[model samples]
Target: MVFLKILMERSRLPVKNFKEQIMSTIHDNPVVIIQGATGCGKTTQIPQYILDEFIQAGRASECNIVVTQVSLLKCVLILCARSP
Candidate 1:
């Protein structure tokens, strides 16, 4: 819960529009493109947001999130950095 709060604080995704726009479009459509600058929490918060929403709706078992990391080194670094 605390960790989510931290991620929410750092996230740049607009909360109001995130639910109305992004999440809804993701559910209603087959494909969606999110364009944003770096440090916008796209790499971290977005997936968490999806998972949280699904869990809250009691559909987490029906959802799957696949993250394809381009760089092994960067991926490892990110995982390490995010670890408490």
Candidate 2:
């Protein structure tokens, strides 16, 4: 219950951010480039993208989406058991 409560109370994350002063502007482009070595929020953000699309397309109630986090077993354990 505690884990669920924390996850529910946590803020919904925003979309990925592009580099500032970048030659390429994502403002006009739907596809934004977010570069990071690893362990970034890419996996977490993709679902938000899908959810937004579903809502924008008026299929939010119909969309049954499942997102998997392919991280280390230990990381998965911690996320599901403790935080979310």
Candidate 3:
């Protein structure tokens, strides 16, 4: 839990500031496109947000998330490493 708190604190990226808008848009749409500058947490945060939501709603088992990256394999690995 402490580790999670620390991670959350460190997640003060610009994209974190727009989390509500992003989640709302995702909930209301079947497909969404999010574009942001580099290091804005686009690669690390959004998918986690969606998965967290699914877990909270008791739909984790039903959730299947796939992220495709061209050259950000490190980000993907980091994200996976952070997962519980």
Candidate 4:
């Protein structure tokens, strides 16, 4: 409970510099193209950052979001099982 609350309360400050750059570009152009290597936060962090921003801006009334990973599911499942 404490851990989850801390996680939920904490902002993405570790990636502040990176987030600023990405957010600036996103603000300038509604469309963006970002490419990064595997395990990079580019896959997970950006969307959450954007969602928070949109909600704060009062523009999240009706948002249709879809998340998909091109990676193989079987391998991912096996990796998860092996992890603690």
Candidate 5:
């Protein structure tokens, strides 16, 4: 889709430093720090990226993705708004 294409175009994972260092650290470490400016696509894009990769690898049902936020009300509101 158009959104996926846009995400791919702007993805920071393509950068060698980010891919090699940050991603590897995330894979190897129990906790990782991913700091970026607001609207930098960290929250939105990372989950989708992981989901897509999991699906592509035929492990969509087996994998569990947990996205947590501090604000429960905001999370509920966003989930409600996105629901059909």
Candidate 6:
């Protein structure tokens, strides 16, 4: 849990400085496009940020965040195949 807490800190992300702007933009728009260089945490961090916002606003149960990655599906299939 401590490890996750440390990782949750925005300071660790390359997008840390832009966190507020990103969240604000998301709040104001129906759709948002986030583009950044590789390892910039776009894929990993943005969804977490949106979920966090919803949680803080007491609307977590109403929030449904979906992130799709083909590689993740492949990994899940591999894990399922390996399971007894």
Query: Which structure among the candidates has the greatest TM-score?
Result: 3
Q: Candidate 6, residues 1-84: lDDT per residue as tens digits? A: 987887776567798778899999988999877877777788878888888888999999999877656678689999999999
lDDT (10s digit) by residue, model 4, range 1-84 = 997876554443344448889989988996777766665567677787788787998988755455556456567888999999
User: In model 6, how large is the Cα lDDT of residue 70?
Assistant: 62
Task: Give the clash count for each candidate.
Answer: 0, 0, 0, 0, 0, 0
lDDT of each: 0.70, 0.53, 0.85, 0.71, 0.65, 0.82
C-alpha lDDT of candidate 4 relative to the true structure = 0.71
Which model, 2 or 3, shows the larger lDDT? Answer: 3
Model 2 residue runs over 4 Å out of place are: 1-38, 71-84
Model 6 C-alpha lDDT versus the unseen true structure: 0.82
Q: Could you tell me every candidate's TM-score relative to the true structure?
A: 0.58, 0.36, 0.70, 0.55, 0.53, 0.67
Instruction: Tell how far residue 57 is off in model 2, in angstroms.
Output: 1.1
By lDDT, the better pick of 2 and 5 is 5
lDDT per residue, candidate 1, 6-76, as tens digits? 75676545543465577778789886656555555566666777898999999999888865445765888
The Cα RMSD of model 4 versus the native structure comes to: 8.9
lDDT of 2 by residue, 1-84 (tens): 997875553333332442233324533676544544454445555555556667998999986545444456568788789874
Q: Write the number of the candidate with greater TM-score, choosing between 5 and 6.
A: 6
* Alpha carbon deviation, residue 48, candidate 5 (Å): 1.8
Candidate achieving the largest lDDT: 3
Error at 39, model 4, angstroms: 0.9
- Which has the better lDDT: candidate 3, or candidate 5? 3
What is the alpha-carbon lDDT of model 1 when measured against the actual structure? 0.70
Q: Pairing residues by index, what is the TM-score of model 6?
A: 0.67
